[model samples]
Target: MAIIAGSTITASQYIACSEKRDKYGHITSRISGASAKAGHMMRDNVFQTPTHTKEYDAVIIGGGVAGLAAARMLHHRGMNNYRLLELESHTGGNASFGSNKYSAFPLGAHYLPIPNTDNQPLLDMLAEAGILTGYNSNGLPVYNETDLCYDPEERLYIHDRWQEGLIPQLGTTKTTQQELKRWLDEMQQLRAIRGTDGRYAFDIPIANSSVDPAFRELDNINMRTYLQQKGYQSEELYWYLDYCCRDDYGAGIDIISAWAGIHYFASRKGKAANADNSQMLTWPQGNGRLVQHLQQFSKEKTLQQTIVYKVTPQGNRVAIDYYDMRLHTTQRIIAKACILATPQFVTQRLIPGGTYDHDFVYSPWLVANITLDRVPESSGYQLCWDNVIYRGKSLGYVYAQQQQLTQVQPERQVVTYYLPLDHLDPVSSRKYAIALEPQQWVKLITDDLEKVHPGIHEVIRDVDITVWGHGMIRPHTGFITGAARAAAQSSPYKNIFYAHSDLSGVSIFEEAFYHGNKAANALADYCS
Candidate 1:
């Protein structure tokens, strides 16, 4: 059917969505589209405030995981005369959640593998948050039983059998299995090997490592080329590697730099007593629980909403100009030091003419949470914590309520599925997302779920599609080299500082926290 742009959509073109379609030929999503457009206008209208208005010791722009972490740390340091400006009403950025009749669930990030034992600060934070109990006989930390993933933790529906791991098994050839084993063994070696400069080849706080160019050169090539050079060619292994890269980094193997790709596997040095290093601590409400704990240290009086327009430095202080959506006024905040924790893309807008030599590549993602009274049972194994269709386009579904492991009212389950829009560039991916209708999105999600569990459509009560247009930046080749870091640090005006995970070229919780902390310290040092 031919649909005209800017014209009232007819009954046939309405594209029915949940409770959006009516007998009167009206589609609620269409109205929602209009509402969303109006919301954007309202948000932009705040920028029209002509005059500057207020002052402070520091102005922190953005309120994502990184921004909030820095805010908490700065607050703890007794810096109360500062303002945290967020475009969104609430904080937590990608770690945000959505609530419905069923329960509150994550829209983006969903889990955190037990962190490295050496990361004492993170361990201390987790303990404070009540996620950690105590150390075992071996000195390994033990997580709260309530937060651990329940039995039937994972399964991959490949070759028509239920496998314990997410890897594709059953109907597999010997060559495929050998290649997979070989790859894993290689990763294990990398995990253990230390650099000549006396640092683990893979460690967090990326700067703490030895300055060895030999291993650093690995960032100059793509993962596909690196694997090819190693003579490890197996279609199944390639697909699995690609899937991992897409799931976490949002980019495919060919696009991600070889160093970053291998680092993904080798960097997770999490050790726990009751759980494996690879195990995750997740909950029904996703990472919202962690965000709540992080917010405990935020300065209550210094947070403002939908403000921050332009920033300029005047000798000793930085002038921050922003618009308040609720008050419909423009205000200014002057601070001794400022931290910008927004994504690189948004950071580009705030800085009028700042240019960095390093290229920042981001991948878009779609996170769907399907609420079901009952998920269709598989033939071989029961419902597991994480389920994936072998070699499928979709990243599969994670049972959000699995951690709690209790029969709650409404008998709800949230299947969080991730799909990376692996487009050539950000512009193309965002355009593709904008083009899809709400019904099309639902169909896109439901069709993929049905592939693994047939007849799942009937059991699902609700479908919430949260599209992260630019989810996480790809750690492509050369992005992590010291040169890239240097390029990112070069400020447009001596006053602005970059503090986004995108600048690090890798999007992990550790990197995000470290990035913010680095920015906070740099700001402090610069002003002092």
Candidate 2:
């Protein structure tokens, strides 16, 4: 089919074998094989007599941000004897990144918004990592200017021209403009609202949010329903909300909960000494830079490419059995306490007879990093850090080297594109995404970009596709305030705990960090 403009050539014809190289690729076949390996181990009751057994004060399963945070907390408490096992060769999980000869680019997560000033723990971590150099005399965070996103932060292609911001301005009706203003006013009021119990209506870390039924009731309905009830009928407004939801939650307003959708706007109340709340700290490798800071806590004792298939709680200790992909052998670890930093799906498999509620739905996603000879030419405004196409199928692309300070720019640049596969259900989306090849992904991405940058295929140097089968947890109706989440956070065994962004029903960096610290503190107290 003819996907590009002004040309009768098919998408396949545009992408030749010599023009594309699939580097830093992650196919879902490996995930399927890993699942099969775990299933077989459970079905056959094969423990595979461990090659060696080691004991630790605590053992963490999954070396993602949550696991890394847990490790850091344990280290802070002076508990040195711990181990972290990760299924992937790298430890960043969804925040992973890859590098080419020209520049480094994000594979999944990319930016972190400026955090609320009240979040002391997060601020302290950032301070330790040197992102937050120190506090000013007014007690506000003084972030490193270099790490903050540079000018020309965001732009949107609308009405055949690029605008200075992502919001719909050109071609928008007067009614749409009024509705947008009303929506912004409502969100600002919501940001200042406090529950009777003295907590913000919507707060980061999610656990700190007010629990009043007034605000919590929003979780019972989808964001689309809430918007309709509020008398918002602007097509442009709906599209913007849908884009925001998909960018953060991997779902649209129709699928995500009203509370989650609102949180995306109201929860960010960060006050900074230099940068504004809307400003974000980013790097060429995206959040992978933050991951590197967290990885230091577990680097010495982490076992990458090791999958923990089973976790059995004995009378006093937990027995963990894992397969080391590199060594090609099974091993056992006995720990006084354990933290399962894995997602609910993997957690269910690790602990036999443990079944998660059906509300826990994960969305599949596709992320591609395309390298080009130079930035693609666009009309209206110049290329920004974030370039969005209004009413496009994807979340647009981010200029990977936007944070660079060098006077002379590199001839080659990489732009990372994100697409949440929300058209079908999660199961169907995963099946569809895994079946696609690199060339298919390249076509899908280039076709989307062709709307703004005509003949964009000519400057392309390479395309890398990473498919996340269970990308992020979807905050569907009632899932955020449901009993399932509360139950999942608590452990039946004294020495076992849980930590992951999935527990929060909205996957983000701050929530993952919060849960990790929460689980680590609980485990440390029990061990003490």
Candidate 3:
């Protein structure tokens, strides 16, 4: 089905239609020559009839944690006249889950640490959701003992020995260890220092931090420069830090801001009653289950399947025009308020006509999930919560079946391996990386895993791959505590609002949730 130039339809759209026909054995749309007759014919046959349901007071653009949280908060406030439009068939954009006979497992987001005492709403939400038991004498909330990460929490196979910590130490020389220690000492000092406004230099929620120019200057340089300036140049340390950045921010040290990199280690000040604030709460299904619970609070019928293309302000209401791929329709939703809970890339596309300068950049991620009949035995420590390989571009693997209370049937496990395409130009790298076939991904994961567990490929049963074209947004130099972020929060349209972790310039569950809640509350003020 070759598309003719000057035709009313786009070539890519025609190709997509062809693929659908080939795979599904049906075609309802056509790509004909440009004419009103062709347009009318296509519109009559291809366009999906819009659901003439009652209008919504507000429409949330995403179905991820942020969107769901916004919906949940709005619903709790007795604002049930809202709708959530998600492009995917399922909710929980990144925080998604999958299941088979063995058990349900997380596909993307998996772990969440307890919130700080200051994060009362999050703590309350978790407690209401039965994730917390109670607070201890120190005011830290205790998580369900059963919910804590099991024994053999983490192990790093480095220097031919399985080390107890994620930080590289096995094959490191004295000089490397000393350098690592020195780097940590500097972070500790930064952690202890407070700004002129009596705020912690590296505080969560970002806005609460000090406005000191000296500290804010750290955001001007990339993490690599920051480390280089401090004389912290050890290959092992560099690899470990780079791996950490890739795992969380989806970018390497050079692309990430120094202050943002430091915040990854220093900003978490959460305290728990029976557990340390530093510890995380996770399940085999990842954070997907949490996303599910949040979705339950919203109106399922109001959830539309549409990819928002652009948003235009029309008086007191915002006109949201979106293309529904499934129904092959383009429709508009007018609402008193709107929340753009999408990533920066999508956000940029939506507000192209506006004057918003969001300098946020994002990185791409490639994740491979392998189902094995049995995990290959490791030479160093036994199978732990997270098993990582030494000196690899990838961050090793996580046992997706480990958190199940029910025994894994047939004695098999699933391993989710992650590799961030942290190239100098992530956009181009993502395009090239995405073009690789599934077998290519399987081969990469199998070969990488075989190094630690030899002859393990024979036991593999299935492998699935997911690509985050624009995964986590990077907080480059000057992003954290910058004015661009402040300006982004300002209203672009009278009724439209922006809520995404990307806007915060830091990609974390806390930031995502915080953004959602803030957007919801801010919009709620105009409800009357």
Model 3 residue 479 lDDT?
73
- Show where candidate 1 strays beyond 4 Å: 1-46, 49-52, 302-304, 356-358, 408-410, 482-485, 490-495, 524-528
Q: Tens digit of lDDT per residue, candidate 3, span 355-472?
A: 4455766676666677777887766778887888766767788887767777435566788777776653766665555455554455456666777778776777777677766677
- Across residues 345-387, which tens digit of lDDT does each residue of candidate 2 receive? 7787788578867779998888888888787777799989999
The Cα local distance difference test for each model comes to: 0.72, 0.85, 0.72
Candidate 3 TM-score to native: 0.86
Model 3 pairs in collision: 105-285, 106-285, 110-286, 140-273, 141-273, 219-477, 219-478
Candidate 3 wrongly placed segments (more than 4 Å): 1-54, 299-302, 355-358, 407-410, 481-484
Rank list by lDDT: 2, 1, 3
- Among the numbered candidates, top lDDT falls to 2
Q: Which lDDT tens digits does candidate 1 get at residues 451-525?
A: 777777666666677777667877877788846565675466666676877766778777777777777766666
**TM of each candidate vs. truth:** 0.89, 0.93, 0.86
Models sorted by TM-score, best on top: 2, 1, 3
